[model samples]
Target: MTAFVLIAHGSKNPKFQEIVLKVAKELENKEDVKRVYVGFLMGKPSIEDAIKKAAANDDILVIVPFFIAEGSHVVQDIRRKVEEVVGNRKKVVYAKALGDHPLIVETLYQRYLEAVRE
Candidate 1:
């Protein structure tokens, strides 16, 4: 089974975790995906913990950063934690941030429209 772990830069606000959970729920229903886990860089069930959980049940684990850019959080923190937890057990794949995707432009536009409509 292939499991996905979405890592986000956590916030003290409850809404941040809520958003990540909602995203994870959406991913869980997709075909070929066995499970989806949410991780926070600065909160509970951290990136390391999430990876370990995914590595436990799934043969392949995909760690996706929800960040906007490839900053230190992605380059250093996320990568380091994944490396430390998984080691050589499960096959691990690191996915790029949302900002790297072309759809992000459309998403931004939608957000703009929402603001303007309000």
Candidate 2:
């Protein structure tokens, strides 16, 4: 079983949390993944707590950041924090942000095509 932990920049608004949770749920439904956990950098159930909770199972863990860029949070804050919790854990893999993927470009292209059609 592989556990996936999604790290996001937590917002104060409940809607933001809801969106993050939704994404986590969707990822959990994937056939390859066994569990999904959501963690926030500045809000409730901080990254450390989430990692600790997921670490209980001895399953392979993958951490994905929801940030749009390799900003300070992704480069320094997240790296430092993840290292602290993942100490001596060889199964942990931190994935790049969604923004770095080509899917984002594809989504933007589809949006532009839709607008042109309208």
Candidate 3:
């Protein structure tokens, strides 16, 4: 079972936390993924706690940054935090941000098409 830790910039607002939890719930439903845990750098259940909670087994861990760009959070902060927790684990993989994916472009295109058709 692989655990996916979705790291995002947490907000103080309760609604933002709710949204992140919703996304984690949806991702947990996917096949092959045993669990999806959401963590934040500046909010509750900080990255350290999230990692500790999920590192119970030798399951493959994948950290997905919720940032839109390869900025400081995705580069420096996340990398350092993950390295601290991962230690000698070889199954840990840090994934790219969702903004760089082609799916984002496709979604934008679909939105534009819908607007034009309206």
lDDT of each: 0.86, 0.84, 0.83
For model 1 the local lDDT of residue 43 reads 94
Name model 2 segments beyond 4 Å from true: 110-118
What TM-scores do the predictions have?
A: 0.92, 0.84, 0.84
- Name the regions of candidate 1 deviating beyond 4 angstroms: none
Tens-digit lDDT track for model 2 on 1-118?
A: 6678889999889899889989888887888877777789989779998888788874677888988988899878987887899877747877888774789999889999999999
Runs of candidate 3 with Cα error greater than 4 angstroms are 109-118
Tens digits of per-residue lDDT for model 3 on 8-107? 8888797888888898899878887778877899898798877777777546778898888899999899888877987867478899987757998898
RMSD values for the candidates in order, in angstroms, are 1.2, 2.2, 2.4
Best candidate (score: lDDT): 1
Q: Report the lDDT tens digits of candidate 1 across residue range 27-69.
A: 8888877678888989987887888788878888888898998
